[model samples]
Target: MNPAEAGPQVERRNATAACVEFVQALLERKVVEAVLVPQHVPGAKVVVQTLVTDPSRLEDVDPVAPVLMSNSATMVSSLSFQAPKGRIAAVMRPCEINALVELVKFKQANLDDVIVIGIDCPGTYEPKDYMQIITAHGGPISEQVFESLSRGETPSFDGYELREACRICEHPSPANCQILMALWGADFSSGPVIVPVDEKGREAVDKAGFQSGNLPAHRQQILEKITSERSARGQKILEQFAQRIGSIEGLVDEFAACKKCMNCRAECPICYCRECIFCSPTFVHESNKYLKWARQRKIIKMPVETLLFHLTRLNHMVTSCVGCGQCSSACPNGLPVMELFRTIGSTVQRIFDYVPGRSLEEEPPFTTFREDELEPR
Candidate 1:
């Protein structure tokens, strides 16, 4: 029997089962040596990226889970850096896939032997918020939330909702991915529609021997509606941030609670520096030096480098920010650092007519120069 037919009866199987079966076929046939996908740990509510070598271990693998623990691009970078002997298949969200594209350009990730599988995102919940919702709902959340999102309704449990990042994301469908598995805006009670973005994906599907079909016409309308809604929401966020940080006082006020703990830097996918300047001795000073600075100002903030640290990071990474919002999720103070970075990033990227992680052929703005580019100075 074909792989699709080998699963449960056509009427009973859902999209999640179809997705798992597809990946299992690849593994069983040795089309790829390992698969990098998210799976809920046994006896845990959290889902994490798991590298599965055995097909039987995929019992808990879920690509459409509403919880995002971390950006998986860095994980892919670590896995493929040494030029692994066999091909690897990875399932990632749109933001994670975008980050991987940027990483590929920076020589941090090798995609020549990796297959990128992207899914139509139905947004995600912040990890802490998701855990709370799961506890209140009293069971696994993937199916429940997926059902709500499939109908274009936001999942709500008590007062909880989707993450701010997901609420305002403009790119819901994956772009520049080799294979795109779609669930949104489709009646997936039958099976998923596997759409190939390139020849590699077409070849992969052929090898897997799964049934495929064209996307429903309504899929385009649904995607456009979602994108438009998200764009409007994103613009509102940018406008609010602009008002909040319109001046030095406002900027400082917004970040006044920052502890200089470097959590944002640590979680940012684009802030990939082994020895970041902020973490180095550049910001470290002697006791007397701190005293001297305080004496000069008569009163200095206890942690002196908060503003400088954030500004420096913005300068270094704003062009590459993919709006993944991991930084804000990692912030202990709950400062909206992602908003600041993305707000500035969108403007900077626009000024240079560049969109980070959109395509491999597009060069980063800072890497190129033209005398006439910024004539006004």
Candidate 2:
């Protein structure tokens, strides 16, 4: 379902400042033990995730910091694992929120103790694209890139900064969360902008002393303008990568440089295996085995069992991929891990007529099956 079409309608404006205040209020009200948001380091404008135990830290709350290298989903899971059993309210973009939901379903996380603050993602730049923008803009970053220029109806980098997967994402606004930060006002247009996705989110806003205002039509127009442009870019990407998605051979070829680094699995929010079979000695071969392969095939695939390795993983968790893109980020060889997994994940999830992370009660595809399904004599 379209994110915009599913929620209670309301108005919003100048939410950037309101959001910061809301986080501070959550801290004061003890709604969360800490507020997980990004902050600007004094010397460098590079915004990193900061766990705010005190409301004062919200002064640096910059939700717009571009996150491509790290997945906020993984961050949340790791924090949940390591931190005390207190409610941790985290500010996340749409994809991060969805990833966390999927993680909860996989038993890798618990959402009962967390307050999610979701934002309307305009999109982000790839790692290099962001660096390039910083370099060209004379170091550090200004609010102008995401806060202003984009609202002016022009992306700062002509699609250079957007990750491959985000360009195709049809759902830019968040549909599920305890709180959806309204960005309806403070932009070019005059109309109603923000509203709650559910009763829980609405209550949070109300508790923060926020009453609904007119959501600006210009804000939606801004979103649509970006969406249309990204759609064109997404179509270009599909055509460019079409052949690669055709078969396993194409998929494998795309990973030709993969060294089985397992970084993808490591950074994945949903990968909860304390001990993975691929990481086990079951797949490890001695030097003799590598030499033996060289003798048999003249040249061995350096990683060994690369295709089998990935397929084994695909068999296990392809249906639960939330497309956080951390796998692609962790790939040292620059494999389009997100593209391959999402392509396969979409197909896998569809088999069970499911959308990963949409709801908690839904069982995974492999966890259940119809008795008469797929019967062929």
Candidate 3:
């Protein structure tokens, strides 16, 4: 059966409240052992993912919150990498689902006992920026965002904007998930339209007791419009960035302020190495080695291999970069790491005809090789 045809619209007035009720139903009905979802932190304006086993604990749940503290893919990877005894459902944004899909291919996560509940994301703010926006509005702004989506318009705050990664993200709608809480072109006042994407999703919807119905008439039309705008914006921005870093000197200059803090790797969901080469003894050069290099060049950056670090990361996972932009948010020096990765990843992924997080059946380009592949290069 086609999963999209089995649309289950949640019957509620407020979109956010509707999503919360649906998640609560999952717990109350025992659809899964636990649900990993975002909730508001008490006494603060922050939102973070929380694993809930009790339905009553869902009072603060806000699955569509317009802020991303970190990519939840890493969290899902940790929980499902070994296949837990009980099934777990993760509510994640489109990018998080994509990143987790890549991790699954790398043997970093197993989805057998995991049910993915993906959400259609318009965009999100950096953690700090989200706090400010919330304060400026004097409260949570998810409802406002949903209202904007219902009108087929991008959500905009007075003085803030979405992160660059989100602005250029072409995949606003999620794929490869068991279930989806669709928002684009939705009638939020009537509640979010939930679509079951697979057998697992259909079963979950049944267990949760949502009646199957037709999807919103214009959801696809609105999604295509959003994707098109983002793709065009991404192309323009990345093209200019590519030209800016065309030369080795230009690339070096762009990363000249790198502190080598490794924050980018720490935030990257695709960089699943338990012990990265950067953290290994391989990069811990002897004192005399630094002195020797300084003498040879008469000058050198204090943290050697800063450029090498970025390059090595690109080589390792650029093919699987989901463009979540957490790396740029993690940078203390405010470097354009996301732009660099997206620009380079666009080229590399195209060369291999791979889109990270697109599917679980397709092997990553790095994992498989064709005898004639790249022979012309």
Candidate 4:
């Protein structure tokens, strides 16, 4: 029987239920040895990534939760380093999927033994903001909002909303992942449809006996609308950033509030390094040097190299940045770190004609060398 014709028989009651059943089927069929998913911790308002080997343990799985405590791509990278024994399914956001693709090109993640399952993400709240919303709701995140999203409705709780990065994200759908859990344009009353985007996903779906269907026609329309809106918003955001800190002096003044704690680097998904040069002894200077600088300038910033640290990070990660905004979310000083990276990184990526995480076939500009690519000054 045709999969689309059989959709009614296999249609799930809700998106969450459909996701749980699909993942459970994958585990039961042994298509993958384990699945990495988001699990809502009991008695806690937080959702975190959990590796599940047992299908029965998926009862608390909520991949659609609006909480982004950490980038899942970095978690996948952590797993990839160990070279796990069997195929592992990773459910991730579109941004996280892109970050994973970039990591694979950087050799920080291995794709041979993994399957990436991406979901249509509208956006998510910062960890703290999500907690506040949950507290106010007197429950876990609202299924009403999650379901409304599938129907193209925007649900808000007072002034609460998605993070800035998510708001301006132009790529809301999956491009690099193997499987895409389609949410938009699907009637939540019938559940989301899972479409395989690659051979790996197709094989897994066939093995798991998932009933598939064509993407809804309205899905394209919805996606295009979202893309247009986000692209415009992204451009406006870049313009505002340029106006605020386009000059060297303006940039210095904006970042002058930096405490030099390196929290942004710590939280960034692309800033992968065992030992950063910023933390090296080379940046450390003798007492006389500090005194000499203070005497020469009458007074100097206490935690020196604040601008240098940002510049070094920008140089190291601009080409690979996926604009996940974890850096800004991690900043203790509320600096507009994400705005700076997205603005400058977008320009750098354009200069190289590269899009981070667009595909595995495209090599990272930093790692590739073509002497004729850039003209000598």
Per-model TM against the reference:
0.93, 0.82, 0.95, 0.93
Model 3 earns a TM-score of 0.95
- Cα lDDT of model 4 by residue, 291-313, tens digit: 99999999999888899899989
Model 2 lDDT tens row, 257-331 = 888889988877677788999878887778798888899999877778877767777788888887777777777
Q: Where does model 4 exceed 4 Å of error?
A: 1-13
Clashing pairs in 1: none
Q: Which candidate wins on lDDT?
A: 3
Q: Please, what is the whole-model Cα lDDT of each candidate in the order they appear?
A: 0.81, 0.67, 0.88, 0.83
Model 2, TM vs. native:
0.82
> Could you tell me the lDDT of residue 30 within candidate 3?
93
lDDT of 1 by residue, 1-377 (tens): 53222321212136477778989988998878899998766655667899999999888777777888999998999888778899999999999999888888777889988999898887888888776665565545666555655565555667877788888998888898988888766664554567777888888877888655677667787788888998899999899998999899999999999989999998888887779987778767888999899889999997788989899999998998999899999999899999999898888989888898899988877677788767785
Which pairs of residues collide in candidate 3?
none
TM-score pick, better of 2 and 4: 4
Winner by TM-score: 3
What C-alpha RMSD separates each model from the true structure?
5.1, 7.5, 6.5, 6.4
Candidate 2 has its poorest 10 consecutive residues by lDDT at 3-12
Q: 1 or 4: which has the higher lDDT?
A: 4
- Give candidate 4's error at residue 183 in angstroms: 0.6
